[model samples]
Target chain A: MSFSPLIQQLITSLRCLPGVGPKSAQRMAFHLLERDPDGALALAEALQKSVSEIGHCKLCRTLSETEICDICSATDRDSSVLCILESPIDVLAVEQTGGFNGLYFVLSGHLSPIDGIGPEDLGIDKLLERVQSSDIKELILATNPTVEGEATAHYIAAQVKDLGVKVSRIAHGVPVGGELEFVDGGTLAHALAGRRSLL
Target chain B: MSFSPLIQQLITSLRCLPGVGPKSAQRMAFHLLERDPDGALALAEALQKSVSEIGHCKLCRTLSETEICDICSATDRDSSVLCILESPIDVLAVEQTGGFNGLYFVLSGHLSPIDGIGPEDLGIDKLLERVQSSDIKELILATNPTVEGEATAHYIAAQVKDLGVKVSRIAHGVPVGGELEFVDGGTLAHALAGRRSLL
Candidate 1:
């Protein structure tokens, strides 16, 4: 059945999110009306507020309500040990693990020559500048293990080789709890190549 | 690694949509930032506009931006034939068949005593008033075939029985193109129970 223009528009808007098709969007629209009208209102409010109020952190390029991000402002985080990531979402993934206490540098995007995204497009120049000017001892490249991600990391590592900072790439392999039989060949190869010696 | 408060809140707020779990919400948030920033902004705009502008149609209670819905205002539609449905979404479902040419009355809910929802809660009084005052010749009860939906339809049918108008409930059974093996036993039973002889 065809929806009214208002509902159709709302469903179309919701389909912009990942994995949301026309059916799922319609279901979500109805669910909002049925379960949590307040949540729908809050979502509308947050969309407006976040779209207008949030901006890139001046230092780390991550999303922030203020000039600098929370990590940049936190004195408890190790500024000397910085974890460089591809985007703001990556920062969240790393943060959710609760294993790293270092500060972060978000590139906002990765380099893709085929897509016309180069060093300047990805903010690699700013990263080099931060490395050159800061008192950072180690620069950990935590970009994805994709071909483009690897190329971008290599390019950054090349540029900072002479900057007196220890540049290292994070190990790429199967996940900790993943089974060998279930792991893809490429990931298994990556894990084998990056294998460490027993203590 | 820890997420900034802004990023965390964005992910959490996104999970309000149906079928969106934490992983999907994270993926959606990333996709918005990475691939379709414009689409995300459009969604934000649509959400705000729909919530602020759309309301119930003054006559039928279906969602609409104006006082009367398009179906209600259309000259080609039969105003004397009204399809009583469970919600605005049900109106869309019927319209998709392209067979019905009548106005719609959205109940906004089904009668569910377990949930404390009754005929009064679903605007049965308003429906009675409309049927009594209007030139309606037929009231088509198109609520879902579930137990509560059936009960609600029966209650409405009984209420309007003395008013001298023809009252009919939509047939409940297997879908038009459904396969026998694929269909559940409950649906087959319903189809058999509501069967009609071919003339």
Candidate 2:
């Protein structure tokens, strides 16, 4: 026999998550219902509040409650150096590092020809307008190392070739503390090819 | 800088799930806000709906919208045979197979002594009361093979040893598709010890 209608609906709804399937959905639904109803209630309230109130920041494309996100509106960041990233989560990662104080532009996603995600879909025109109107001197491409990320970075770099701004991609290398033998061949090759000379 | 209040609360609340950590919570919150707001809304609705409507079955202690669960109330099931499981998810697993025709009693969790769980905590008295009042001739202990699960099954079997019911465990053996070389030592030992005679 199948689950009750409510249970079945809950399981089906949970399948919309990134890695969850039918079995995992069922597990999550039962877990919420049986183990922690109060937690489930809190999750429900959080989802509703965030979905209804949050929207894309007009300047940076990061998620925000208002037209401008905190990062985009911060006064202390370096306005001359702009870092372009694929998503808000990446912004979080960069923020956690506390290394770069540059402003950010969120692309939301990388180009995928098979999936039909192109320049217009990522609001490349808006980014170009921002770059042209601002006093930006250096542009950092901080997108992932995937094929789509490379294509997006290349497209943006070509667009800004005539703008007389320094364009750079984040260095590719074996992660800090990771052994060379365990690193993938592609990453190893990139790390070797992009080696920097130490003074 | 941190996320907006709504997003932070969402990530915090999502962390209430079993294996979810700070990173996974952030990932889930971002996925809900960015990729599928509508699906997130549906999940929120489902959580609220199920949490408010679902309650324990009065007979077998499984989750149900009504006083009696669907399995317990079904007319075609064998009322003389009762299967005891650790959680409602186990009930769903058994139901999915469509093999067992018996009713089920859900313990919700196994006895974890270090965590302060005991017989009284799992409603063992309620299970005993039902066994005494019902026509249950056999009790199948379908809890997991963990130490806590074993203790729970043993406690239940001891409670019903004098009730003129046949108490048995599910089984211990190599999983259907798992190879012998890859099987853990504990599992392989159980598989060897519980070897059956081919008819």
Candidate 3:
């Protein structure tokens, strides 16, 4: 409990990460001190570099080193088909699948009305502008299947439907290769309601 | 795989912690990036501060801010009963029990011949000097229950026995809360050999 000022400082700082409490922070601080001094220095440098260098892409709001992210700049990607996602990590998920050739519009966050977050806060206006300006054929809503995620997707779908751009929401159900027994009630219900013909 | 340079750098640095591999490191880096910029900055500052300010205690070789650690400076602690441990974390473990009021002697490591770590490498010479100079009545070998821990304890016990000091090694067995069926054979053997007469 009576760690040095510096050790205390490090522990206090480490607690800022989600789920890292005081005890974990202390453990992590001691871990860095005992094992890897160079790693600590590297982490420090990386933190500074990340904060100073990485910014939002001008077009999609995805994290990027330059004004435009690699996804936005790639000419090979389908500019006509745009997928709207909630975060940069989601973009990575989609990228990993290698299924869609479309570009993305990262909202950076979803609408949480109780937390004072709304459509304007999530760059929906920019999304509309991009939809109208470009020869975009389809707008795919790929937000998560949470309550707020569904609400955000529906809100966006309503706003963009009249603009003549065909809007579609990503299917929600049990994950690929997942057992039906393990699937939750909400997901099962959604999967049933949104069911399509197998043929 | 295609993280931004800053994000990738952060993830790489975070992997240096014990039990942290590439995936966990990536999660930590992303968590910090998405949630707490201020916390990340704080952790970075603390890393630099802890590395630069904190050093080993002159007497015990344990991590400390001053020349003599708080435990060494305390008048209530029994200097005559020294507990020799393998690392600073061991000292914390002993202190947490609040059962021992004695000072500590940290080896910073154990004797591992296979790893090219021996008596001299683990500060056995320094420990002998401390025992010889002081009015030490008892020298408690409280190292871990590993083979290396036992070897180091035996090596130190041989040296301290010649100095007319009472050398004793802590008992090993199934932990207090551990299930008897799950306890390992080596530990059970050690426990049986060191059995005390129940009154």
Top candidate (lDDT): 2
Candidate 3 per-residue lDDT, tens place, A92-157, comes to 899999899999999968999899998998999999999999999999999987889989999999
TM-score leaderboard ranking = 3, 2, 1
For model 2 the local lDDT of residue B139 reads: 96
Answer with 2 or 3, whichever has the higher lDDT: 2
**i-RMSD of model 1 (Å, 1 decimal):** 2.4
Error of 3 at A145 (Å): 0.7
Query: How big is the RMSD of model 3?
Result: 1.9
Global Cα lDDT for candidate 2: 0.90
lDDT of 1 by residue, A1-199 (tens): 4667877888989988878888889888877755566777777666656666677888888877789887899889889988989988888788888889888898867788788998998888888888888899999999988888888889988998998989899987889887889999998998999899999
What is the Cα-based lDDT of residue A39 in candidate 3? 85
After superposition, which runs of candidate 1 have C-alpha atoms over 4 Å from their true positions?
Answer: A1-5, A30-38, B1-12, B26-42, B196-199
Tens-place lDDT per residue, model 2, B1-199, is: 6989889999999887766788878888899999999999999999899999988999888888888988888898899999999998888789888899999998969998899988888988898998999899999999998998998999999889999999999988899999999999999999999998899
DockQ of every predicted complex:
0.51, 0.71, 0.64
Docking class of 3: medium
lDDT score of residue A63 within candidate 1: 75
lDDT per residue for candidate 3 within B1-199, as digits (tens), equals 3987777888888777666777777777767776667778877888887887788898898888788888998888888999999988788789889899988999968898888988888888988988888888999999987888988899898887779988888977778988878988988887788788999
What's the CA error at residue A44 for candidate 3, in Å? 0.8
Candidate 2 lDDT over A119-178, as tens digits, reads 989988998999899899999999888999999999999999999899999999989999
